[model samples]
Target: MDRQTLDMEGARRGEISSASLQMGEDTIAVQCIATMSVESMEFSPWETATNKRAQSLYASFFVINLFFGLMALAWGGLFPGNGSSFIALVIGGVLTLLGFVLGIRAAMMARRMKRRQPYYRLVIGASDGRRIPLVDNNRDVLMRIRDVVRHKMDSGDREIRGDFDLDLDLVNLNLPTEAQKAQTLSRGPDIVPKSRQRETEVEAATAETESEVLFDQDAEIIRDAS
Candidate 1:
């Protein structure tokens, strides 16, 4: 049989295994093989709209606050009457400061959300043109899958015939050293009063027995010499 046919058979039988191997002193590579069907690909319109709406809301609030603050300050400066001028100035200053803080915080949140949002999703396209979702909502993973799909399409391979293997290289496995392992083992259980007493007694008995044996050996040697 041809190699393609063998691979196809393996995929159909779900015979692929996932494993991890140490590639270097600090690097490890994980290999996984799976049979998957790609249905369709599209960007998320809903997510884009939601992001834009949130950004707009924050921007609108900031602009409104800033405009009102400026107006209050202008009124206070243009028309100084009794204590009304002081009140207006204080209100305007507080509002402007609040608006500035809010604007900054909103901008930061929007940027963070944009970074986290996944723009693409993979769907299982059915014969009827219906698409079903697959995989988690992660932009990086989706981008990688998109690249693979594009490559396959560009190569004119329309059909997937066999098991697909994915190799992921990971750095800093963060494994413990031998000394760390020994320390961890040594601290396995706390020494209770009963256990501590038993250990001390065992040590004392062992030392006494050893000393008596040494004394007996010495006496035998002296008798022989005499």
Candidate 2:
């Protein structure tokens, strides 16, 4: 199969070979994969439909109760039927209060439903106990990668290459500490420019000469003591 570049730290300039999965600068051998799974999370279609129906019911209930409450209050106020009128007024007030409460609840539920979004997560477990979790908004892309990995592991393919544009920010992997960062900086550049080759060589030679001089001075001191 064709090799794909993954803008990842471990893969050569984000390039992945068939034998391993590159995560930043670390490689996870395909053969050592013990478990892999993809999970999708979203509001179920049935649940969504049911929610809509319930919202509508609440709205209908609110309107019906509110209308009846107003009518009862109007009858009690206009006709002045004494005891019967008092009971009507009490019932009307209760219905109106209940309607208002239900209306508010339906409004809140609608707002929450509007904000919901689908999420997909892929988790892979290695034999060495490393867990790789990949989360994405797109289900198809996540599933495709999972399928490819499964195929390679089962078929014993030597080459696994694919073009993957994954958001690095979504990955919650361990990051280097300040000490590691300082050590890396002290190590200097891995590849020096050709133009600086002579300067680099001169610097190396000068360092070696200084080390030798220090060694000679130590030896002379030891001889004097003897």
C-alpha local distance difference test of each model: 0.50, 0.69
Model 1, global lDDT: 0.50
Model 1, total clashes: 1
TM-score of each: 0.35, 0.38
Best model number under TM-score: 2
RMSD of 2: 16.7
Query: Over the stretch 54-125, how does candidate 1's per-residue lDDT look in tens digits?
Result: 667777888888989998999899999757989999999988888887788668656655443222333334
**Model 1 pairs whose backbones collide:** 39-125
Candidate RMSDs in order: 21.6, 16.7
Error of 2 at 134 (Å): 10
lDDT tens per residue, model 2, 42-153:
5322235567888889889989999998888887898795778988898889988988998897787677656645666677789999887665666676676777778778
